[model samples]
Target: MAGPSVLLPLRSSPFRRYLLGQLVSVPCSWAQVVALAWVVVELAPAAMGWVVALQFLPSLLLGPWFGAIADRYDRRWLLMAAEAGLGLTALAYAAVSLTGGLTLPVVCLLSALWGVINALDTPARRALVPMLVPPAQAPGAAALSGTVMLIGMTAGSGLGALMVTQVGVTATFTLNAASFLADVALLATIRVGPSPRLARAPRQIRDGFRYLWHTPRLRTPLLALSVVATFAFTFQVSVPIFMRASFDGGASLIGTAFTVSMAGSLVGTLVAAARGLPGRHTVARANLVMATAMIVTAAAPTVLVALISLTVAGVAWSFLLMSVIALLQTAEPAMMGRVMSLFALVLLGGTALGGPIASALAAAAGVRAPFALGALAAAVAVAIAWPGAVRPADRSSRHVTTADAG
Candidate 1:
């Protein structure tokens, strides 16, 4: 058989359908994010940070449990139900906006609810990717997924800005709600068989942790990722504030900045896809690049310079994200759901913890403070990861035990 090509995963009917659904749904999610940030900034500028934190709070609390559920249940049904629930939540937000009853508190409530749905969906969706393609194609599939998401985000942010400025927030929310429904429809067509059943085990969630503990190679990189996630991913909280406070720009400019960033992300994803999955040393190097980019972004004197810096940051960020995920998937195939959940927990939980700090820093020092903090955190992650990256492959390979084998 021929080795997997970049487009090989798309040839699978189930994966193709899932990709189509994501192409629509991810853009809507991005649009909603842009709209929600704008809405909070307009209604209660003081609560913007808190509102952003709320979106990730559920992931910190429920990620592990939900990941266990993904391992135990039918992922397709879980994903479908989550998509439906997301649609309802979007509709509720739209109704509130259209009725002139939208408030910061309401927005926060809805965002938390949305976060809960995501906590369930994310692990299941990730776990299903391997099931949809041949093992050799998994890396290509992951890259394709990342590329599609970035494309959606790029278009979605721009569309969201135009909708908010011209058609208003109500329209933006309504359109997002529709997109979820569309995703649900597409999901219904994917004809994958049920996942293999695992034997019921005591302390299933703890088992995932134990597995990680026994595997030093995986543990080191994941810990490094946790640090980076805490500091670097707080951009969602900082970007809007920076645009409004520092640059004196509005939604359109915010959307344009996001577009540029995602364009860079697309480039990074394509590079990783073409070259195949990166190893630990490459991921460590990507962290340093990300740190440099963040520092440059923080120091940018003009909006133009900031955008260029953000683009570089975006590229580095995408490379790091894809590399980490590919590493996790490659390391543990059987416990993928639980492992990925742990990954999600570290990343989202870090955001939950860091969002408020970033917001407070932005409130006090300036909007650019978080980027400086992110640079420091990234440097720390690089230091922690470097030794692991240089460790002998023979020793690292031996760490994969029978327990981790499928």
Candidate 2:
């Protein structure tokens, strides 16, 4: 903040402490992600897609169910439990690798376990923000949450890649496991009021769909977003293979790619923010940029060209995703949570749907094929969105971040 007046959210001790925990934990998570891919590639390159699928499957299958559990329980405590579980999961992952007992099957099991822990954690984590602060400062907390993750990405990927090369993937896993303990400890120190027992009716899910189907404005953009997500979100699975196949690069190279790509994402996000509220055709425009950039990235002749294009893709992705969430916020206030939930499923959980397919494309067609697939999917998104609504963005929606959406 430029001044004390601008940092109201930080005044809340609970929220501040929580953010500190995230600053420590999120980087380790990214480190684990970078190392995990390399291990899978080394063990069974063909099965990387399966690993991707297992890693995200729980989010697709259990998100709503887990969200309900968060509503019914004390979110802070639930988050603590989930974090502890994740730490243990990471430890188990490290142990297997250290003992030379890591196999494809073992990796898949741990990946699935990690996914389950994340699914259990997300709703609680999202809800805990508001609980940590007053409503007036909730937006600030939400905005900062994304920033924390971006900072983590910037630090973690470069360091993780270096660790993969210098020390090995085993150290990355161990550090990540250790990082989770910090979060657990920090979570224990923050106190919040007891949550009321909230019961969710089963029909709410059906009703949310019914509303989306009837609302043309929300319906069309979501459809387009769905198409784009099915391809674009598998960057980790695709890009590592692209590095290996195209440039004979390894995990450290993958980390470098992620670092540059995320830096470009930060630049893109700043550009979008500088423009203020998303203008007319924002979503359509974002898709067009995204598609074009991904195609270029897929076809680049050299590592430098591909890395530049990857950065551009990252920029487009921020604009594309943030705008969609903003559009979702324009829905009726009473149904906002449900609508957001729908967006989360399509945007984040669809990783399960896309990961396996993209991996198979990489394994069979060529490493460049997955990014090319994204380009095609993004082109479809452009087509679907171009003739649709003007994509009116909610003013409040401007603060949304890709991390929060995830």
Please, what are the lDDT tens digits per residue for candidate 1 over residues 1-406? 1234888998899999899998898888888888888898888765777887787878889998888888888888889999999999999999999999998779989989988998888888888887889877777888888889888988888888888889888888888899989999998888887774456678888888887666665677788889988888677788888888888989998888887888888888877777666754877888898899899889989999999988888888888777777767764555778888888888887887788888898888888998999999889989988877823234235336436532
Residue 208 in model 1: lDDT: 81
Show model 1 residue runs off by greater than 4 Å: 1-4, 390-406
Tens digits of per-residue lDDT for model 2 on 1-406? 1234336777888988998999899888888888888888888777888888887778777776665566566778889999999999999988998999988889999989988888777767766666677654554555555556667876888878888889988898999999999999999999877664466666655555676666666778888888888887578778887888899998878898888887776665555544434566777888888888888988899999999998888788776665554455455433444565566667667777888898888877988888888999998888888887555634455343322332
TM-score of each: 0.94, 0.87
Instruction: Look at candidate 2 and tell me the lDDT of residue 223.
Output: 86
In order, the Cα lDDT scores of the candidates are 0.82, 0.76
The per-prediction tally of clashing pairs is 0, 0
| CA lDDT for candidate 1 | 0.82
